[model samples]
Target: MTLLAGARVFDPETGETTRADVRLDGERIAEVGPGLDGDQRVDCSGGLLIPGLIDCHVHVAFRRPEPLPRSARILEAVPVLRGLLARGITTVRDAWGADAGFKHALAQGWISGPDLLVSLRQLGPTGGLGDTWDPAAGAVDNYGDPSLPDPLFDGPDAARAAVRRMVRAGADWIKVGASGSMRAVRAGVDVRPTDAELAAVVDEAGRCGRDVLAHAHTSAAVVSAARAGARSIEHGTFLEDDAVAALANAWYVPTLSPMSDTEFAGTHRRSLRLAVEAGVRIAAGSDLAPRPHVDLTTELRLLAAVLGDAAALKAATSEAARLLRLDGDRGRIESGLRADLVLLDGTDLDVTDLPGRVRAVWHDGERAGALTSP
Candidate 1:
């Protein structure tokens, strides 16, 4: 048993803070209240206690810029995984690229990494973002590993089949490129999956008990995806009034870090404001590839700019866990839940400053390694 003493606990659900002591037994929280007793006591005076941060979109196994062997590529991803844990991200939803092996390794304690909800690969039509076909070269770009699915198809029938393939490949969630890329191909945003195709993908994934996450950045794509019953829209970059109305029943994940300085930054920021005003559930996602240059802290700071500090903190904690359907097992500082928690150095810091203030972290009741600024 371990007791964390004298810390202010932040309740994500109520946006309130209270001083309490939390006791851990094995892999679960035994109790939470004032003056808890345990075999091991750790002083946590003048600190903040919050649920471990969860990143909804990350590509943990993204390959290096230069060519490398398949074995080397997998090996190189280890440091990035460790880096995420060190910076206080206890859970991550891999948008694509990470395979089931990574999750299994973490479960068995073979490697150090955040708990993973992997999508395996992204599905889309030919010539879209997931296609990677070069007509001039007469070949497709190799992703270095053949174990992952090839996410390209043409019609509704193929779309249904692709969902089954992803399920067989061990996908926890199905990721589809509903709209075009905003960076690589500006023309791609104008192109998205047809309504029929999108519906088929959602239907098949539903039958397999998996939710579909649509990569949408344009108004047309957002409306189409919402109508087709996608669980969430990945990046509503060009969301409009019509799109907001269409998303009345869905969640929005505005990945703003990569576009923070781009020309379209203000447009998406405005879209976020509209989404908030319309009562849309907003979740935080960096849409970040696990690389040396990316930062999840920057993503949280940007979200704070639009949704205030408390709301932005909820976007990454309680709200993100709800979006991933893991709120029951984690995401709160209550008893009878998994002991996934983060400790910050101060009690008076704003919730948005969590990543930078992390002093220690605990994953599944075990304290992780040395901490670092995000």
Candidate 2:
């Protein structure tokens, strides 16, 4: 048993802070109150204890432009996995390109990484995002890791088969392309999966006890995906009022980092404001490829620009867990929950530049990572 003493716990839900000592037993939080007793007490004075951060969308094994071998590509992501945990992210949901082997390696202590919930690959229409067919060369792009199966389909039956294939490949959730890229739509080459196909994918994933994450950027796509029973919309970039109404029972993950410099930056900001005003549950995702870096703080800071600091913090912590269906297991700093917590050096609750202030991290009641400086 261990006790984290003297830190003030910040509740993401109510935006309240309470001075308490959190007791840890094995892998769960045993108690949260004043002066909790434990065999060993770790000094946490002048610190703030909050739930460990979660990133709802990440592609750790994303293919880079340089075209490396499959083993080299996967090895390149090892440091990224370690970096994510060092930045205080205890859990992550890989949208695509990471297979079940990555998760197993982490569990078996062969690699250090955030607890992973992997989609393995994303399904889409023939000419959509996951399709690698090259008509000019009459060959498919097989540069990606073989662990990720082909992700192309045409009709509803093919879509259902694609979902089943992913489940068999060890997908925790099914990700489908509900719409084409913005550039494709602007170029008048949009080719989204049919409504029937989207519904069939959702139904098949549901039969496997999994939820669906729909990659949608347009308002029409958002409505269609929500109506098709998608649990979350990936990039609601062009979200409108009617689309917000369609997401009454769904989540919205606006991956703002990748769109910060695009021409549609202002439009994406407006969509986020609309979703916020409409009371939509919003989660922050970086949508970063492997080259630059895996940083969720940028997304959280962007969210802070729309939502206040406290609420923005919640978007990455408690709210992100809720989006991943892990609220009861490891979201808040409550008793009887997994002891996935981050201890910040400062006593105050300013989440701006959160990663810089990380002093130590605990995942499942064990000291996972710590910074050399605060």
Highest TM-score: give the candidate number: 2
Worst 10 residues of 2 by lDDT: 365-374
Q: What TM-score does structure 1 among the candidates reach?
A: 0.95
RMSD (Å) of each candidate, 1 decimal:
1.9, 1.9
lDDT (Cα, tens digit) per residue for candidate 1, span 243-348: 9998988889898987887898999899999999999999888887634546566778899898877688788889999999998988888999889988998886
Clashing pairs in 1: 180-188
Error of 2 at 266 (Å): 1.5
- Looking at candidate 1, the ten consecutive residues that score lowest on lDDT are 183-192
Q: Give the Å error, residue 179, model 2.
A: 1.3
- In model 2, pairs of residues that clash are none
